[model samples]
Target: MEVDDEIGSVESKVDGVGDRLCSVFSRSHWDSIKDSPHELWIVFVLKLLSSYSYFSFALVLTLFLSTEFQMSDVEAGWVYGLYGVFSTVFGVLCGWVVDWLGVKWSLFFGAILGTIARLLLCFCTAPRSAVIVLVTALPFAESLGIPVMTIAIKRYTHTSNRTFAFALYYSCMNIAALVAGPAVDASRALFSDGVTLPLTSIRLSALRVVLFTSAVSTFITVLVVFMGLREIEVNEDGEIMPYHPPSRQVGAWKATVRVLKEKSFWRLVLFTLLLMGVGLVFRHMDSTLPKFMLREFGGSDDAEGVPFGMVYAINPAMIIVLVPLVGMVLTRVDSYTMIVRGSFVAAASPFWVALGAHYWAVCMFVVTLSLGEAVYSPRVYDYTMQLAGRGSEGVYTSLASAPLFAVKLLTGGMSGWLLERFCPEHPPPERNAAALWSIVGATSMLSPILMVILQPVLHPKQSPNIIPPVLNSMHHLEDDNASEGHNSESSNTGESDAEYQTGFGNLERLRRQHSSSNSSSSSSS
Candidate 1:
């Protein structure tokens, strides 16, 4: 009875301490959150929905171009590459527009454009031209979604929790990608079998139905944004205050120039460039892989064996499991180290695809690739924002899209040329498959080497002593309290008044010097 009572008392004390700790931590986090301007929960949901439309289209398009159009590895590569190229170009322009016109118009326009692009794709018949035009438009339309969403996130969240916000954002993107694969497959199977559509005799291809469905989804997303998303004004404290209806503005060129001048901005640009190059290879794989399987692994008849589209699903499927694990690793490790290691994984992806003969091997290769992406993708964005600092979120995010565009241009041309060069005059399926995998593998390997060099340039080290002005204010309060105590003691003891005044003056001067130094360093570095 005595032992039981003692145990209960100890448990009660532990519970009390735990409760107090929880309250303190929760209050601190809440206070930090309250200081932020925008509502993160609402924005997170909107971004998830917006990403779904884009990912759905990409997944369906990859299978469509590879199977129905019979595009070779390089040919399919160009199709996907064009998407990045156009998106990157428009993303830069969109950044300027978002900074000037605000998030509302940017999102509105993006949705409208994305809807139109999908609609245009549904009408396309000629494979090459259709692929080119669709690729070109898809990026521009989708480009608006990320930069504006990022800006909205930055406007609302404090620096401490910004990484968490980006992680959530990226996870949403992967979720969309995960959903898109199976959804596209199901949608294709439905329409191609004449089960869902009105027409009985004419069974539309899966690609056509998927494209139409994606277009409708895009339109729906546009409607939602128009109805639900409101633009918030940023206050002097750098908090997003309240929603105000947007006003038309000319251009964000001046703001663009200011952002370009920052050292941190350039670092983000380099890092994203390297990261995007690594990611672009995978994007190309979505288009190229199905065709490679069909050509190399004997996936001719739909009823005879596993569908090539199903194989493409492996990466996203693995991502659902791997990302949280990667997140755990990120908690203990610096992002740059993860990125470097992830780059090697990315580099190895094309080789696995090239070497693998069986469906299972291809699936395994995809799993490896996805694992790397699961780590690298979220970290890249998180690191970029960390480097960007307070008000320059939009600019940094937009600039990050630039290298992707450059890669697209180079890859698009290279892909087309490689296909034409290796498999000239309607080459056999075996030769086409081999050539495609070889090119992809070579590029994938090259990407990591580039990233290794670029990583250090983009994320330079900063001194720990430099604190932001907001933090400095809190330090001043602590100093004031210390000084009060010292003066009270001096009064009691009748200490020298001149010495006390000198000490206070010196402390103030040191604080001012530190503040000035930080400002200069921030501007210069």
Candidate 2:
């Protein structure tokens, strides 16, 4: 009753805000949004812009290393892998920054670092050193923003709408990804003819021009954060929660350790490891899978970009469409159950890709993988929020990204090893690529399977031997229903029993008719 009343109050307040604000969209259109406060929309725009900035430069960075710097696969691994390593480490540490400084200052610090990194990428030409600066600086910037973003989402929305909020958030990330692919091509094309300075007569190449644009994007993002956003703690009781002063560095570290010592953290860590492995396989769609397609399948480099970009776009496209629908259905299901199911389904997508001899097969892979992604991906954070406490949001959120760090560290070099081992640099004869997918698919799929198998043991509530209250309640309902049937039969001179029989007959008849219609439709189609 309290929750219901609170929701009602929140709704009325939000509706009033929506009505008062004049905008391009009508009040009804604003109402159609997930009933969040106006402040959250501001945060949402920040997320969209931040994602665009991150992916735009990142999409081309690895390729630049290999093509421009002539870095070997192993050397490039450090360029890519170390960023993940440091980011993951910094993410864990940023818990302190987030807890103490709050989103405003943390983001302030991030913007500064991001601005510097973007500027360096725009002009720096020394191969190893430039890449190293970017890898280090980029994570330093994101270390604050990434976890803080999740904490903000958790703060600004209620539980009922949190998953939907995550969908919107994840979709923005995907939209960035969707745009980044084409943006890569567009950036490449913009300065292909080369650029001459107005008076200095200095020249610049296509890559440098693209990096300059990336720097501009970062600058715009910094402006948005500095001018538009306000930092606050979670909302409660028709009031904004005041930001409580968090502990200093040492104290924050102690608090983080204390949080980790709890059983839920360990359980989450175990589950994260399982889920992250599965994610590594799926995320390769962006990282290595394109290179795989270009090498194994025969197509000109120019044409390959379009198909691969389309393939990257498809996953996010499906996610944007399906997450809300899947969320509604999975609301009653346990998070782990959803994770288990999604992992198994994702495992098969690569199997189909293995069967292929063409680029279309990669499209098929994205289609199959996306369904499971929509179902399970949002649960990752939902599960984290459940485990975390109030100010400790940063600590837990960072830990949640542990899988991303782990995957980057493990898979960056591992991909090259697999490619060389299975596909070969130049094959004596075309080898079976099926074996490659089978190895990755099977190995990756083990994580979630292990999670499902271990869930009952780790969490008592999920144990099969334990009877749920709902099942016990249903038994009582059936008993009362049977008693009522008996009473009706006794009161109605057998007419009620006859009516029951008639109802059952009608139900069976309808079922048969439905089956017949389905068969006819199938045959006709």
Candidate 3:
């Protein structure tokens, strides 16, 4: 959140400080966001603090392992990959738990868990213990917290502002990451080597200083969620709905099987899988890219050189600038189209690095990648929210990460091997940097291509409206079934494929056809 020098320049030109501030943003932007719920802002704060801690610590995690524990690049990559794999896996587990625990308790539990994990990392000196602490504790921290926050945002805001709410939620994460870059560098510079504890003869590395600060932020998140958050249900049309706790909840296994039985749920899984290669790009940014930059480009903060953390920050910073603008401008476009087009742009990003190993090329790669992520990533949440059934938002949203489970699972080992071969610390004279990124870029390019090829099969054809037509029609059909002597449980399981395919207009036609058939039978009799 540091103000750029441009703010000072604008201040000098404008009549007053308020006018300078006003000039930076248009009236329309402010007006559009005026009615957002107060809880949404709390969610933003929680997102900022929690994600800041996650990314800041993440930027240094591989370095921490390599330096503090004396792990090799390959070893660190496996552990780092394990961290990501478990994080997503736990996210799926936690999503089901959220349906049982409710949003507030889930947030509280996740924040406290993150705090404890950071504290554990601070004290652990051995590689075995550190790995144990990380793989066990930290994975559960933000993994569950993110989905809970997404559900919180969905509940707090009306449909009118919900999309922007998601975009802003994502922006808060980038803003955290945006600030984490300088913080990472400053922390590194402040402790040129490492700092010692006052009493116990324990030494803290520069990275641990960042970790400790993140722990404090997570502690603050606990306080904020406990004191600030409350339950508020918002219906599809922006109406305030009464909150009702389910009297009898199904077992997680049964609930999961129920969600899996739905064909649409399978489509979501397929879509998530198709996007996995591009998804691995994000995994590489944290697990592989930092080490790649330090080894290949060297870690000098200068005009000719770039620091890894600073380079890491570039993506989030551009995303912070671009997400709101994209959300605002692309309201008319379908989420499927946005995802496809944006994946193409993002998939092309690594080619910039393939063309050259210079800092300029790295900058181009990150900036281009950021632009594409800004276009598509927030829509991911929006699209997931659309597919989610009324009471199963957490389950459906978390299930989206199931495909990512396999993505991160393979990428961890894959990244380690790639770095060893192409961008190793000890270089063979025949190192091939272009081949490294060419592989990554080519892998990512499959997403958009397959997405286009599989659209008719996977994507639902619906108008680009606040609520998707299939979900809307499904809700209406459920109500009709309920009034016609069908119980909720029966309606959920007994619906045939034809009933599920009834789009908004087709649903009305089905009702008319049913009525006409009934009348014709009675008259003939």
Candidate 4:
């Protein structure tokens, strides 16, 4: 009878211990997630407004150069190409500046510059000189926008949640791209119809009206950043703390160089260069495809013939549908794999473009290109963070934008020259198709090739000190406290059960003793 009673007691104790452990584990897991710092909804709003304004400007700018300025495909290409080059150069500088000045200031400066550039476009009459100045100023001014926004999101978000944050960011950009198409198209149609002002004496071209609208949009973005956004502060001990002014003066150049020295950083830079090179092939599709359709596809050059404006609509539309889905998938898949797959799809876009016999075929190719973008776009920043490791998120994020700068410098002038040379003044269908295919095919292939080579280099290695020493010290202190608690519990457990029971009176009293012992054990454990 005594043996059976003791067995029952043992069983009850085991159950009790198991229940306690399970409760502890559940609490720990919940705490971990709850403590993670990601304001997903707020980040989403910022991304939406920023992307909307930026892409809206791009859509208007493209349409204005093509229609109002009466620029040829080659001339329009050069003008836009120059804008890209300037933006690229300014982007490199802005990446460093974002780290030094803080994201808010960087964003504010970029927005102001962008607004001014757009407003200037409204008043300028000489297309050549105006195009040159706007091209130069707009990109440089806009350079700060993306890098600053990226840094802000990174600083505020947690590692596990960052991929989703970026995905949301990319989605907003695509959404903007989608909205810009109809907006620009409508503006053009309205302006062409000569809609008179309600009270003003000024006559306006559709292009002027669009430029003014773009400037206003930029100003609104500036207001949002300044008024709606809050700065995130990092503690000197290298932990995320409440927003406070930084005391230590860190030079942007030093931070940039430190980032450059990391092997992973270069690997990511190479990957971005490849990705941008590939994406640039598609960027040109908006400017080049319309002209190709007009000259070679037997489309009328009149508003109806390969309406270039219509092609712009396809990418944005596809992006709106695809981006959210891609964001959810990013949580499960390896980002590098997504990038590789996207590159392969992009490389194949030219073949699709070449295969297009009808306008629908052209539209299909554009759709394919946008699909590739949907997959690739979200992963770019996620990969940059991985490459950044710990202290260099700002630098890596900025570097991701570098490819846009580099590709434009290397290919912009050449693309313009090539179109002028190979695409005839009045291109036949065959010649136009060939030129478009060649450009897309060559540029698209480069991204995949570079990505394959860089992938091995980009793989994450064990980082020795991603978290700062001070943060690590605090973690060790907590661990020590926990360890001491566990040690005390174990020491108490060594005491006789009879002695505990004799002193405590009942099972409930024994449980209180056990709980105290266990609390100490937990500290050690």
Candidate 5:
């Protein structure tokens, strides 16, 4: 638990800094979060470290494979595209592992895989590591760690703070995103040829240095997670709740069978599909775009890293800046409204690249795309959290990856092939821009349409607030004056808030409406 002590010490230092900076906000805002548990802070640290490694890996992947294996754009695409496949497949397996061993061990195992994969990249040669093997193994290792942290956040924070919890998670990820870009660019410049150590006289390329550093960082992350994380149960209102620890805990396979049978779960599947479709466009920027730029625009590997890292970093940087503002504004709107409108903005970004004629178009694409992503991405997670049941966040969250799986299977594999086919070697970037982007754009546009069509069938009259309306209403009852004021206006809110809010205590019915849960509901604190 040395890592736990280290993290705690770091948090104390940051707390002092954070408090002084936050003094600009009104005191009430601080009061709401002043007493947040230490466990949530731990989750934030994990999010930051995990995202740093993941982003750096994504940033350098195409270049690494190209430089090392002498693979073509098409070949690099498939190897890189394999991440989508590995992540989709491994994400599910990780959920089961979480069910068997719990969140901490699931995370540890995933990090171990990632550490080894990155370490392998250090010593890899065209013949030694083998293209096919690295493609599959690296993705498998990296994908496993993602779900555990998300599940932990879900477990640790209740309805009262989930919005902020996710915001904190996203913000930390963006800070990493901000750093990952610089890391990639620096690595490229620092070791474009190779670096030699004075004592050992070992030389390594910038690529290997970055790759090995990532491996060491990931290994340290595994240790941090092992020593620092402890499971905490939470109820819907952001209150710490008792652990269920059911004597006969259900397995992931059974959960899968039951989840598949539920009509509500099928609706959940539809939502996942739509998310994946949009994500395909978002992902192309990482997996395919870097290689595409080098082939079409004509630059050395290190040079491309400059603008390419900015492209990857910009999206999350905007996300970090916009998260609080988006949360403040969008929370007043309905989920259906935000989902529809946000997807509209996101789908338009890639087409801009298709229409433009410069290297900077990619930057524009990320800027426009991130605006929509900021609004919708967290909502998608919130909605999925709504769909999960007692002690099933791990499994339900696992289902979220199905969309990425679909992207990998369907779109990811095709991206490289299209680039290879449409943009020939030594051609201008514009040569393939319209033909390739139009197809990507057309596929992306379908997601918002699907979301709009599925809304009524899946979540008829669903509101923006994910907090079970009853729990929200019940909180008002604790205050006599507030309850009286609420009673006076209950009729005008449409459902006679009095009747519906009162009746919402029947947790079984709410589960039926939001998700199909067979187990007893965990009542809100």
Candidate 6:
């Protein structure tokens, strides 16, 4: 009743905020979005601009390393892999920065670093220099950028409206990706033979042109953060207000340690790690597909035939059209179930590529993959928010990115080997492209299969025997409290029992109480 009343109060506040914001979204979503603060819109623009810049350069990062540095597919893959590995590591290490500095300053810091990295790319001619730039500043910039953006989405909207808020956030990213496709192809086509500046003998490649453009977009992002955004938080009454962490806040390291000690954190870690298999397919799209399209189809980067950017653009294009629809339709589905269903669909996409080396096959792969992604990816962010404790969203969300680190580690060297063996720079008549994709397809099947097998364990309320001994002890403690008359009349034992179940947020709260009690006992002793 209290929850319902809170949601109702939130809705009443939203109803008076303003008129419908965007007609493109369905009527089902308008109630949720109409009340969104102007700051949320600023975040939308920032995400669009920053994402467009990042993806435009990322879409060709592997190609640039291979061509400009005169590195083989294997060497470039290792370098690209290192970039992904370190970037994710930096993200994990520095996610607390967002929690410490708030969204506004974090955006400024990350965007400036990104701008500096992109500018360096335009002039750096040596492989070692490129490697240093990619693994250091670029990683830190990317690491800080995403978690804070998502945290902004969480804060700038009402709790009841967070589903649509995250969906819109996902759509903004895809929309930017969609725009980057043409920008990439156009930049390459216009600067086909490369261009030399009047005063200097240095010539700029198509890749460098894209990087330079991306750099300018990143600079604009910094300006948006400076001029258009202010740090804000949703208050206890569910109203938007200026940002402040709690007065008794611990340092970032202590906070992280407390989070680590929670059983829920381990559960989140296991869930994300299980997700690494399907995650690899997304990584492969960037790492492997460009080379596949170019080599298998015999097309030059500047040529009209088989534009990789356009082909890559197809996924995000479909996502932009499908996300809102999926959200409206699947509003009642549980997050874990959605993940299972979506993983099944995504896992099958690579098998389409296994069918042949044809353009139609790759297109089918992307279309199917996008369909599954549209169903599940936004929910992943939403689900993480559910798991996070108050003031800890940034760290929890960053830890949720743990799967990508594994995926990157696997895809880098694996993609290079797959390409060399089957879809090499020069393909022979007997090249077995089918075998390569077949391996990818088969490996991706692991995630869904394992998820299905582990269902009983993941949702412990359904099968109590599968609960670990630690959970059993926790349950015993609750039982003792109830027996000792510590239970309140309003206590919901079923809800309490399901703390170890998936998709509940208060597990963190419960663990904290348990920890505080233990600490108090120790101090008394």
* Top lDDT prediction, candidate number: 6
TM-score of 6: 0.81
Candidate 5 lDDT: 0.63
Q: Which portions of model 4 show Cα errors greater than 4 Å?
A: 1-43, 60-63, 66-71, 196-198, 233-240, 243-248, 294-307, 326-331, 389-392, 399-406, 418-431, 460-525
- The lDDT of model 2 is 0.61
TM-score of 5: 0.79
Which run of 10 residues does model 3 get worst, by summed lDDT? 497-506
- Please give the lDDT score at residue 47 for candidate 2: 76
TM-score per model over all chains: 0.71, 0.76, 0.80, 0.72, 0.79, 0.81
Per-residue lDDT value at 501 in model 4: 20
9-111: candidate 3 lDDT, tens digit per residue: 4454333334323433555434434765567788899999988988888887877787778787678878888887888788787777887777778899889
Candidate 3 stretches with Cα past 4 Å from truth are: 1-36, 197-200, 236-242, 245-251, 299-306, 460-525
Estimate the TM-score for candidate 3: 0.80
C-alpha RMSD by candidate, in order: 12.0, 14.2, 12.1, 14.1, 11.3, 10.0
lDDT of 6 by residue, 1-525 (tens): 999986785575344222221223445455545766778888999999998988898888888888888878788888878888888889887867778878888888999999999999878999999999988999899877867898888788644455567778889999999999888888778887888867989889888888888999999998898666877876423477877754128989877877778765766777787788898888788888888888778643233455888988999999998877665444333456567778888988999988998989999999999998987787777666655666777777676666677567667889878877887776453567789889998898898888778876554433223222343433432333333222212224322222222221122322343344433322211
Clashing pairs in 1: 37-240, 38-156
Clashes of 1: 2
lDDT tens per residue, model 5, 1-525: 999986786676446435433432435434444466676777778778888887887777766776777776667777667666766676666555565566676678778888887777776676346555565666666556777677677677654455556667778988988888778777777677789856877777877787777777788777788555765676654466646533126555776676567665666767787776688776787766766565555544435444566667788889888766665433334444556667877887887878764677877888889998886776666666666655666666666566666467556567767776766555454356777877887888888777666766666654323321333332222232224324324333332221222121222222242232112123321
Show model 1 residue runs off by greater than 4 Å.
1-39, 62-77, 126-137, 193-203, 233-240, 243-251, 299-305, 389-391, 413-429, 432-439, 454-456, 462-525
Candidate 1, residues 1-525: lDDT per residue as tens digits?
A: 999986786676446445433433234434434555444665666676776776666655544665567775456656666676777787776665566556777777878887887787776667866766665667777777667777777566533445445656666766776777677667656655534446544445766777777778778767667555556644423455664322123235656676778776776666666665576566666544544455455534233234655666677677766665455323323355456667777667766656546666677677778877876666665565555544445666777667666676676556546545543324542354455556776767665677555544643331122211343433432343345434323332222121122121122322343344433223321
Per model, state how many residue pairs clash.
Answer: 2, 0, 0, 11, 2, 0
Output the better candidate (3/5) by lDDT: 3
- Evaluate residue 356 in candidate 1 and report its C-alpha lDDT on the 0 to 100 scale: 49
Candidate 2 per-residue lDDT, tens place, 21-52, comes to: 32212233233234565556766777777777
Candidate 2 regions with alpha-carbon error over 4 angstroms: 1-37, 188-212, 248-250, 297-306, 399-407, 423-432, 457-459, 463-525
Q: Give the worst 10-residue stretch by lDDT in candidate 1.
A: 496-505
